[model samples]
Target chain A: MTRRSRIVGAGLLLLLVAVLSACGAQPVAQNWPGLTVGGGRVYVISGLPQQVYILDAETGVQQATFVPSGGEAGLPYWSPVTLGGDLAFVGFAESQSGTAGLYAFDPETGQERWNVPANDLILPAPTYADGTVYFGGSDGQVYAVDVESQRIKEGWPFQAEEAVWASPLVAGGQVYVASMDHNVYALDADTGQELWRTEVGGAMAAKPVMAATGEVLYVGAFDGRLYALRADSGEQVEGFDFKADNWIWSEVLLANDLIFVTSLDGRLYALNPSDGSVVSPYPYDSAEVADASDGLRASPVLAGETIIVTSGSGRVIAVKDAQRQWYWPSGLPQSSVYTTPVVSNGWVYVLLMDGQVQVLDSEDGGLQWSFSPPESQ
Target chain B: MGITDIWTVLILRPMLNALLGLYTVLGGQFWLAIIFFTVVVRLIMTPLMLPQQRSAKKMQELQPQLKELQKKYAKDREKLAQEQMKLYKEAGASPMGGCLPMLVQFPIWIGLYQSIIQALGHQPLQLLNLSQNIYPFMESISAQIPLNRFFLGMDLSLTPQQLGGLTYALPILVAFTSWLQTKMTTVGGSGGEGQAASMNQSMTLMMPLMMGFFSLSFSTGLSFYFIISNIIGIITQGFISGWEGLMFWKGMSLSSLLSGGGAKGAAAQKTSSTSSQAAAAGSGKGSQSGSKKRKKKRRRKR
Candidate 1:
């Protein structure tokens, strides 16, 4: 090409880049719902027009599919499937208008059992306990719905000052919920009355994890601080607020005496259970360790001696005893893993953003089998 | 790294960090951050823009000579193109000069767009993605995770379609400002009455409409960026080409449209008609002289 033509070609290429970028057909990374295992079936939600796929846990073959009733196109399933008894609960949003709600379905028959509607979008998966399903809504309310009747509990919708993006935790007959309004509340499970609300200094999205004995609760907030609160009194544990370099979006993992917490800054802190002190010499940094732009969102899953963690930039790293063991797909443009991998029966199942599920050997991080959703097929 | 990764690192990441820095400095007010960022970007681009403006002015001045060359070389397309290039070089102007700055700024525009999406992550997954792009040194930005997205009662992270009502005004403003900028840039230059002029006129209308439609579906933050950028571009162009290029008030008053050259009380339609007639008269004189010179050369060869 002549010099002028070459210059024009480069200019056109740059213009094309700008036009493509501005055209806004950007493929948004999908946030796959967390998987649920029950009755020999693995329940998963995937795709933009969200559908519930029930697959054989061992075979990874599709057994049943459930599409929400409204027949709305482009509705996304933000909340993962929550399995309790025979029913699976999922939340979906109408993409055009932002109207959203939760639906209960029978996994075996692929039938809609009940749906509890809400005015705003629902992101947190519903928690089931004591014949009551508890969840938070974007409308700044914690709702308790009856499992059998599939209706909102009477006088049961407790309002918060801002949106509640965290899943409600029910322990010791008290429902603990976190809100974007920077407050965490402990409500009476049966009466829906507020017991105590404590300000956590930032918007809370991660589900607060409670200890097995129900004495201490660890909540990560957008303020980059992890607060260990007394589960009963809703008071912060003395000197237990661990500050990270960035927001904490993943739930704190409690394994043995060590608490594993991942920050958006890509560092995983192993804290002491008694007090919020760093247990490791330094947090396990992902490959993008120095770069704060990428980090772990999928909470760490402990399988035997190994901890399986997925980073926001899409690398699945296996660490044992604070030592990095292995990471898969050692190349550029890795698929983002948004849903936490489900480790069950010695097999690690990872759902990628592109609707592909890779089941790896839990011990060695070797790929066993992979399955893509029907939409990809 | 792959192209997308390289783009994110070199363009999107820095722009996002700069925007977040502005957001922090502006006390977390996202709208103010957008406005200030737009101003900064435009100011940085000002030097590059001068070459484009100069080339445009030179191209306008060369129009009459270009017409003579076209008439002389009507039979030989190659000769006409060569003569055009010769004239352009003599005038110290390059056709690409008008587009080079825009090409340079294209990456910035795309980067700005990506920055907007990455910074104002409204959804959970988007927020997760945002976490990966933030700079580690920007502790202040990291602390403001879930940055305040609301500006003037409208969520900047949401599409205008998602927020019906007065939020529609953002898209309208985007279209209006875009159209105004296009008009200012295209109206005075390329002064002619032909298919090219009609095409330019249509483009001035169509580009803004297309952008407006895009804004309807895009996040409001992007729409805000488009509107602010266009306004800045108009002001920048005004400074270069004189304020007469601006067409406001539905083009009713002719005096306002004319530059301050003592045509103070002239009617708008009459002044525009007279200017076109004068341009045509000048082109006619050039064509006549060129044809006579060609005839004289033919006689001398015989």
Candidate 2:
């Protein structure tokens, strides 16, 4: 009732506002921008704005923007843009318009071709092979979409024990699915019948990559170990497991005879594909770089003989001959890198979580061009 | 370390670990883990919440005397302030007693929410963030990387709007339970007068609406936490302080009930009955008006 009491009341109200606003719901970056390079163009699936940017990979110029069926900006288009078979595919885990599915766009004009709706979130990037597209769904199933009819293949959508967050690896008539159920399954690609599955005892998020021999497959797990399984029977190979200090979420990159994998603990391991033995002077720790204390998350991209890597601390480093060649910023970066870097025409495209795209020369780690996409309308 | 680091170490990390531990123990049932975690947190915080409930009860007990003091010193502001403070002192109650404890618990509430979001790890980046917060020894949690999100036909990661249908009922239930908890802890006659009174009135309404809005906006898992936490809070408040203010439908408008007009006496009667019950529990000094009514009833029976 008193004037002082009124002042105190007003002050308390202001404090409540301050505290609530301070701990308020932040705009979360659930996933980094999905970036991939193909056909001389860099395709990016922006997270917050939910727009797909088709940029000229050489010049970093925006060639076309593909906004999916929903015009709203909040729909999730976090899956990597998959380019295959005359169409570019993007999967939205969930959309603000209450629709979720795999959407295909004409890469040339950035126009939508067809959308195959799914019952749940489409978390993994769709892999297009032969005439069909294979992708995993959050509903714990892998779907094969026929490109011609925009329909799921018959006897399809084989269910796994848990959600599949990793892109399916389609090779030699088999679909390899790594699921959160802690198992890697091999399914007959055409008939959607389970052939064999190997229990890794840890949830997997990284896509399975086949060895150059086409007889072995490599997949990483949250158990902090990378397992080598036979691509023919999905059985773990003896004495071929490599352990890391933390979770491996990045897809394993296979270049020539070496397998490059990054973990959340800032370690990058290069192993011989034949036996999972560490490459000499390998298991490079990215934290050794000054102010780059965060882990290495983005998968390494190989350009000619040079290997380009990005870290959660946002540093872009070029490594050659098992040595760090050049690192970017030389101090600290403004944003972290989570999306895998894309390499094309001697340029490495790194997309930071803050929507900044840095096109650095792959040979010297020099900044070639940089631009931040405009805010979503 | 800075404030953010301290918060992560002291609050976020511990909560994240405990919630994940509970998840592992609960066989990867994330919803059940959240519910159990909320109950454990409420139980742990009872010491802080007890003083707040008792303080509110004491303030409610002195409402009549406060009204009298206001009327007697209506013409003099300074005198009014002095008399109110003196009355509060005599009753061993402080008007600001609940504020400090409430402020202390605010961060815990926020931390609990943050932990839930981190543990859910619905998105890749969120999951990556979780990997950083997990304790080195939580290998079971590592093996169970992504927790199962769907429960009772609803995806725990999606908002009510995204879930749609029956999931929308969660926000309504959240608002109802929040209102019930607020009513149970609120001092009587907060709807009466004074700046403090008006603020309490506004808070009683705004807090539940805000909670409901948060329920609607946040993931269903968080909303589910809100409902369980509120229900526990209401029951805990009932045990700490007698169930005096929860007769919301009987009427919350103190001025109208005190105005002594027709049909309003029914609400007044219920209020006195509950107040007498509270007095019987040795919660407060009996009101003079209540004692007079008892005496009149005794005489009429004689």
Candidate 3:
């Protein structure tokens, strides 16, 4: 370990016994601190305390923390989002009551550029494509918000049966939302009208992963199944089951043709994209998987050949197989590290529930540094 | 605004959704999801907290001087006010350092409070002001368990109501944890800055009692965070200020120092410290450092 690492580690190691003294003895405070890095700045929004913060990507000193002046900083987006230009678009809902709006923020100041108003507080992650931002809402509508005007576009609000809980994916002018309605909707990016909406067994809670060639859309549902859909149309190409205990709330990680996903039963699964069958590192219980308190909200991020993911209690595992790999833990329990670990350059950044943003070394599950939002005055 | 809705948006929904997400990313078992959540929060807060910790230690170091000023000024009124302000300025301390850190924690505390209720099903009403939180299990569990478990008898809840021996281990733990916290933590005053701190005494007494009360009233899990958080805080404080305090205590015991008692101790100590440092620099031992080097250059001219 380096000098700084040793200081932090030694501080943590000293408290291990005391921290682990409780029954659940897990990490505390949960977060979905996914990375949206580029232009020397990294951005993340906290699920609690209802504020969004920006950091100096290199030093990690927080640049700002912004919350809507009028609304409560409540339930916003629950997944990692992709941003564009100076605008960072995330699923923007409020603490309670009213419509879930699409929140637009200035990455430099974390201030609101504008809010595209909607109906419920639950929000799906948003993706930028073809000059438009696409995300889902609890109002059971898939929304297309204009990036430039920061307003709900002229003709959109395609209705779905249930709330669109997962982040929306944009592939080839089509916005995809995996909804609790047990269906995945493929909508035209410009207009919110549905191109095609297909049901793939159970409630789909994760954003579908689109193929590089934009040929297939890989999505997972609570039924513990992974379905491959044709991009142009919403027809099922292939599907596989990761049947386990409760739900498969995470999205699929597609590395070329090898599809990786996890089930509520604590098993990491690998399936074939062509036929939804197991391939390379087929099926293995993660080196660290979810336990009773975790919902495994984080999606898997690929770091070269290894897949990195965090469990409910905040234990993050970086693995290539069922074989023992490297692991590090969030010292406190029930932290709810639902955010997917986002990798950039050689580092991985993630958010914690206790309002902490952590940076880790991808090669080993070692911590680089951790910072919290400025204690707002 | 409403507890139920706050619970929904800040705590329960986000926590569950994230938990659900982690389950999908890693494997089954909600515990891992919670773990992931915990690490993220700690790591994020670590940096901001370093400044807060330093402020806390500075507060502790100034306590003795402050207490003396509080006494000397207890009656003088005008001069007391002037001297105290000068002392604070000289110390370069914020009298209200504690509040800034605590204020910083308000949103987080609210978030945590909201998270537990929604995540556990105790209060879904506050979430997004929406009545529809698909998780039905919340209402059922919110009623029976009091949800509070004990880690060696500390009441995880810390509200004003709901404290007693009947609520399993939470109440006892609250008192014990608070005792340790109070004993270990240096001071509640504003690091000898800002305002007079009669309320701080009550704060020391009321916090644990309030925790005990809250434990009796609510779920054990929230109480659990409190217990762990307070315990962790004590540990961190111990590590950070232990040596300085030990040295201070030993230094105070030296010949003629202990004789000063309360007021005498304060004045004597502050003057001695300032004088001794100046003397050290004047004698050239401290000249190697930046500030002292400047003094050395000035002396060379003379």
Candidate 4:
């Protein structure tokens, strides 16, 4: 009788929740605020609307959205940057040449400061750490603009076999950049000299995350392999093939002793940080495909023990790190969420590529709030 | 460079011929052409698939004996393998029987999809041979279905074709069409349980839907292919499951005749089952007593 009551209660709760979700069912959302996570501020780059959305990081309430002041025409969605404090940087893309630059915005007020256009088109978000703002461009140069002067400082454009798409990573006075050349280059943070380079199969779209020890760098690749290289010398530390049946576009997330990653094959992988092994509890198999984006394209965010990952297929799954059990999915998206989810406190902030940034509670994966573009301008 | 090459001769030509036959018979209705094409494909595939189905039925009959043999040789894998071979021989069932139907069906599906794309000819050049003038209504229907709505609305060329294309409307279209296609083809068997299977089914439906939705920004031809192929597939599956061509006519007839009656019967059965468990069960008193004891224990525990 108790079992029956429990089942009934669960069924009722599920039915009620389903009904509510159905009422507020969003169209296939393309929320891809790519990998936005910082102190207390949650940021999402609304790629199509051509604006940056700032919301209460934990509560998912709309704080503000900043658009280019002088009637900005194009959307700057290719990349966005967080400066740890309240400052956020966004990059605009254009065909060949236009008003493509980087704007630093205040997360609280949605106000924009001076616009810093690179010598070339800003391809991705710049990295802001250690008194320097670092980003690369299609011009094949890694621009290190002084944070204070807001001008291009002594820059070192490492020439790759092809173009540069990934953002630079800073660790121990060095900036690590992965290139389409299938090489991970360790550069001098001060001078921008190529320190060392290691060839990885396929291009690396994901930025490398420095192991808490600042030795091994973990990043996923288009070759369907997760590579771990020595952050210092660019030597292969360890590696594992995702064999995703497709490419691995989702970046690797290191939380606790495990790494969370996804594939374009519609799978979320939890791997071992030490050896790049995905064991039983920490399955090599994907968690829940956020969407049918081919594989898991969204980056996974770690909120304490729970790892939240979204997919191009439009599913945001909460994976408990220790047990490796899926808590619940926020909901399937009508489309894919190309960007990663930002988890802070108890909330997971998702930047829907379809134009809405949704906030889901981390505990039960319940929808808390959603900030969509104001429809009529 | 043109997308079609000599490989077109092997797969596309045959399918196009089939499509041409259906289109000719149906008087150029896009929907009817799809139905005819699907029927022709399944009929052609049926001969190749017969051997496989028989083998599977044989396997099912052999499963019980195989399990018995497994139990008898629980301690010996070598002996178990030898005995299993004997059991298989006695049953006259090849172990690989199940994969045959799928093996025959998979290619037809792929070929059909490819043929649809080729027929729609999203590329202006490929459009050269497609017979768009076969029907007066065709030009408008062709415009309604997009070419790049690849699978669901997916631009086969783009990653998250909808998202990558930066076109949001496409995914929604994909989902709707995919749901329609799935409902048309889903197995009607009662045991539709298991969370994983449901998840898998949804994903399968979603992938095409995502592709279709993304196809909005792409060439309309791709979406047209998806719509036509799915409509065709559902028709084909229905024909295959429903005793060949007869089921479709019967289903159409029955839907008109039985929809209301069916609903009432289901509801009435539900109400009667609640009021009369004995009648619903229709078993002896011994089984009733056993069930009652269990129910009483459950009540007491509560």
Chain B TM-score, candidate 3?
0.56
| Alpha-carbon RMSD, each predicted model | 5.6, 5.3, 20.5, 22.5
Report the lDDT tens digits of candidate 2 across residue range A1-377. 34565566567656766665665455655677778888988887664766788888777799998877763644464578898889999887445455778999989679998998887777778899998999987779789999999899998989998878899999999999999889999999999999998999688988998888899899999988899999998888888868888888878888867899888888778998767788988877787673333677777888778777788878888777668889887776878888888887788888887777788888788889876788722
Error of 2 at A74 (Å): 4.5
**TM-score, predicted candidate 3 vs. hidden true structure:** 0.51
The C-alpha lDDT values of all candidates are: 0.74, 0.77, 0.57, 0.55
Best by TM-score: 2
TM-score of chain A of each: 0.90, 0.92, 0.82, 0.80
Candidates ranked by DockQ: 2, 1, 4, 3
Over the stretch B97-131, how does candidate 1's per-residue lDDT look in tens digits?
Answer: 75666677668767776777778775676666676
Model 2 ranges off by over 4 Å:
A1-29, A70-74, A92-94, A272-280, A290-293, B190-199, B246-302
lDDT of 2: 0.77
Model 4 lDDT tens row, A35-66? 47575666666545556666666666767777
* Among all candidates shown, the one with the greatest lDDT: 2
lDDT of 3 by residue, A262-351 (tens): 755456677766776666555666434435434455677787767877765576777786443666664544455656677887787877
By TM-score rank, best first, the candidates go 2, 1, 3, 4
Q: Clash number for model 1?
A: 4
Q: In angstroms, how far off is B167's CA in candidate 1?
A: 3.4
Q: Each model's TM-score, in the order given?
A: 0.86, 0.87, 0.51, 0.50
Write down the C-alpha DockQ for each prediction: 0.29, 0.40, 0.01, 0.02
